[model samples]
Target chain A: MSVLLSPERVEIQLGERSYPILIGNGLLGEPRHFDAAPAAASALIVSNTTVAPLYARALRDTLAGRFQAVHMLELPDGEAHKDWQTLNLIFDALLRHGCDRKTVLFALGGGVVGDMVGFAAASYMRGVPFVQVPTTLLAQVDSSVGGKTAINHPLGKNMIGAFYQPRLVMCDLATLSTLPARELSAGLAEIIKYGPIYDMAFFDWIEANIDALMARDPAALAHAVRRSCEIKAAVVGQDERETGLRAILNFGHTFGHAIESGLGYGEWLHGEAVGCGMVLAARLSQRLGGVDEAFVQRLSALVERAGLPVVAPALGLERYLELMRIDKKSEAGEIRFVVIDQPGSAAMRSAPDTMVREVLAQGCAS
Target chain B: MSVLLSPERVEIQLGERSYPILIGNGLLGEPRHFDAAPAAASALIVSNTTVAPLYARALRDTLAGRFQAVHMLELPDGEAHKDWQTLNLIFDALLRHGCDRKTVLFALGGGVVGDMVGFAAASYMRGVPFVQVPTTLLAQVDSSVGGKTAINHPLGKNMIGAFYQPRLVMCDLATLSTLPARELSAGLAEIIKYGPIYDMAFFDWIEANIDALMARDPAALAHAVRRSCEIKAAVVGQDERETGLRAILNFGHTFGHAIESGLGYGEWLHGEAVGCGMVLAARLSQRLGGVDEAFVQRLSALVERAGLPVVAPALGLERYLELMRIDKKSEAGEIRFVVIDQPGSAAMRSAPDTMVREVLAQGCAS
Candidate 1:
């Protein structure tokens, strides 16, 4: 249990609101994430179907010992429920439990649960504090780190979210044990993004350790999770709102979100969509002369070795263009992809159709 | 024409990223708000049905003339429409317009429009720059001043939103001419809030000039707008998120939001609800020993003079308690109100039902 918790404090530097993200295991049962939260008039833990069976009791056990009062609100699982209705469940729970201003929401799930919970926290009382117990590889490595909490809009995935930094992000790496392999690989999509967009050296490391990383080897996984959070924490610190520099972190998200939205929620795993999206983004970058073909090959090789989707579906080039247009990355009609100008540097660029069609073709190729 | 078209600059002192709020006569016809905007490749204006008919064309003409290209998306109006559907209208406009990362949005209307448009801009393309052109007095003074933008959720008012600061806010006071009396009165509720929460002198000024403000006296209106923006700027500058000192600004908002939710949206104008809400909050403050009964009488006079509803309806104490419990401000069953300790000073206090019921009776009394 001691070894499960990290001594290193993961800092989310959002001015006065900045707080330490404790990345570890058994910490859910520890006093930090739940019990140690400032004693409020009341507290409520918001979780989802999937993660509750695994960690809710442990959270309650830890928190129950500390406070005279506590309540839990369990929500239905998956991206489909990440809407206003799902968010209302938290309100229903709070009202039922009689929780008030000092209520602390404990998000006990992957990205979807974390997002809805965090969003409920943000809007619950204009705002309230929430602890992120990211129970997925993607959330641990990415979503739970940056404090970008949101629920999906019908027209778009994650279209209605906020740039709310979290009071705490607890990445219990051990939770990945319950995650499906596809999800594990999807999380790697973001892990891969970290390399091409910010750190070429990290990309090389990920490439070298692809097998171990994919196998969820504890050492490789920890190294990846810790480094990913550090990179995200650093980027978020520099630009908390994804204005300019932080947009680069969405290297493949522009194309990825489109795929998620186009295919419909839960149709494609977010990381899977991102994985295919990175390939398209890399090809488009090469087409734009921002990134050379070799870098594209190197990135593609890592994605393939990690058992992630390297090829997008054969949704016609026109359809791909249409889908990408609806993406969050697009402003008006231009499709902007976070493309690598070079290894360790990324830029947001609008890829016009012919070249985009070519990239889409390449991405769809087996 | 150049000088007449120019927007008056109100500098909100934040940092390098902070931009000026433009106040003038016909800025919609000129490129003033966009001229100083960070040079983007394109511009997108998020306007609602009512606003688009009157101002969107002028805004588009200016932006289209200034930027390489510009686009306008007209969303439906009213607080009820401020949801995922309305937000997507912005997404549709952005995508259909081919806007890219460099796109900036101009929000044109009152709080509903500003909030929805701002939230749309905040999430679109991960994040984007937006300028506020708040037409109503409430928006000019309150919503348009601090960049607290959000969209409302059906379960709760403003349950989905972010604390996304705007690049600039343009308040064309002339737009208030078209504002309905109810809308104007709603906006006035926010204007009056500034006096009790942070500016006593302003409170005295408001009390003295309530008639002028109701009559839409230009000088009085402008003075109220500028002062509220200043007070808001100072508070938001210190605490952008309502974590500590900022929560004081919620003086009547907690009670008001509950009323908005409990009564069902569209049933009550936000300002009218808040106007009555502040009376209850003041009474609660009196009960809590934070302020004297004199504070209650003095504030009630201004509220009544503004032609706003000074008495809350008989929601039934149980129903009132239930409604307040679902408020974004409530957590464990305790309903907290931002009560005045004295003029220009406010603090949050959670009261028991006996006191809240007593206040409810007084609040609902005809």
Candidate 2:
């Protein structure tokens, strides 16, 4: 049984670049949802091969009424394909079709599609307008909402990108029904992230409604997506370029990125690594006198309950340290991490290698 | 004889992102020129093979006092190498050296190196502080002053890039002494541009000093670089994103891009194509009754005197139209040319195919 409700909107206040994140059921295939898009003669919907087979026609048909010409391009699926080569596919298609600066691009599918398309729009002809139509839970609540668009380098995740915001983000709740269970858990990791860094109450709510969220309950999912976007939007609005406050959003990313990089990206989903990374970062936070052991255990239990991996892969401590030293947040080869300074607060700080090694020894599988 | 004088500064008044363009003799090897650069533990000087042998060491040595560690990377020379692969080399070096987000990047070459490095700094870890040390006259006068950085795609020149500004632009007039005569003329092509689009007095001054400029007279060169930067700074300060007025700076670029793209990039220098493109664009302006025949002839004579090709490559009418249609300014497959509306004014507008074809027929080589 579907719980019918009006679409919820979260405004990301980025001055001239501000846009809205719309969350609702059956929003796709609805022409009204895309009315905020800039007037253009052409609209290109860039989706992944996996997502295109499911929802491309609905989107193209919906945009047809507004744009004189609507086109679709499908890139190969997954994080493995999120590189310059895959990004070039979008540019290649745009050039082939003679898409101009006014031509808007719609990013369909998950984080990979959203990121690559967002970057394509950012770099194509200096910059062009693009909209995010997030089809996965990870994208809807996290990647799609932020203007942080990038592609992975062999050396680092999001090593190449731009701080370019999308004109609008459409989160169709209906798309979640098709997401794999593993991906749903991964999305929960990012949802769980906002709580420890910015809002303990939201964290408490996530703990309480964890089961309902897993069941794809529309009301529960809607609440989770809206709250996550609200907190993220508030943070991003204040510091769009991650000068200071924005780094807090990357809470589990330092360790998560290491795990992803150590094992090679795509070995574990970004959210899965973040889920486990949050647990390790929490333990590190406790050791650094920011939190208590009780808080760390409580967070770990929630990450496991959400079905994300609690144990990081057994990459050597040296490799973990090496990978993290190259993190975007690192300075002068020193790894700076977003650690829980308090129950509802986070800050970027550096810990000694001894403490980091101890956490890795305890957190990684032998 | 050397014209020793105080460094002339042209402040590009872009709020917050604003920076100064410093012009004078021997500014490159002086540490004082880089004082405005952000304090960082490391600095990477990215140049081309052709330029690194001449100036990389002096730049690195000067930066050594400011940054704890100074690095150098020399890319392959020429416009042919301005692609994603070359851009990635900068990323690879940064990551390899464990350079942090705070690491400063110095773009220490002509437009190709500057464009690639600027784009690299703009994208690396989202963004990093970079300074433009333009060695070529073209770069000093045009490319380096504006934050228009990009790498050429197979389909178009600068199809992928960002409007990221540099912290400082250092135009060492002394470096122009080593510039090849052909490249020197290419630089004059840009200097000639500002006069026709925004300032007729500057055009008049240029006509009076074209011989001195080609001869590399220190006083004439300094005035040319400074005045060109002033006109550019005024234009860019008002329209940073090329939304309206900034497009005027590209008066010769639409036809220039087609010429470059038609013959393939690197076949002729960018300024050479632009030089000829201005001649064609001026003739088009005459056809549209925006300017008289005398004005076109004046511009054409000036271009020829500058040692740039006045005759366009005979790429054929259909190919020219096809190439122009894919230009970034084109909308809905219609080409928009930045034509001279009056003697010292320009506007972007589309012309009849017959008219464009007629100009192409006469302008191109037999």
Give the top-scoring candidate (DockQ): 2
Residue B180, model 1: lDDT of 91
Interface RMSD of 1: 3.7
Q: Tens-digit lDDT track for model 2 on B1-366?
A: 595667999999999999988999888778887888999999999999999999999888888899899988999999999999999999999999999988999998899999999999999988999999999999999999879999998888899999999999999988888999999998999999998898999999999988998888999999999999999999999999999989988888888999999988988888998999999999999999889999999999999999999999999999999999988888898899989989889999999999999999999998
lDDT of 1 by residue, A38-69 (tens): 67656677778778888888887787766667
Which pairs, if any, clash in model 2? none
lDDT of 2 by residue, A1-366 (tens): 374566899999988999989999999978998888999999899998889999999999898899999988999999999998999999999988889999999999999999999999999999999999999999998999879999999988999999999999999999999999999999999999999999999999999999999999999999999999999999999899999999999999999999988888899999999999999999999999999999999999999999999999999999999889888998898899999999999999999999999999999999
- Per-residue alpha-carbon lDDT of model 1 for B55-154, expressed as tens digits? 7787777777667877777777788888877777787777556566567888888888888887777777456778887878878877876667777655
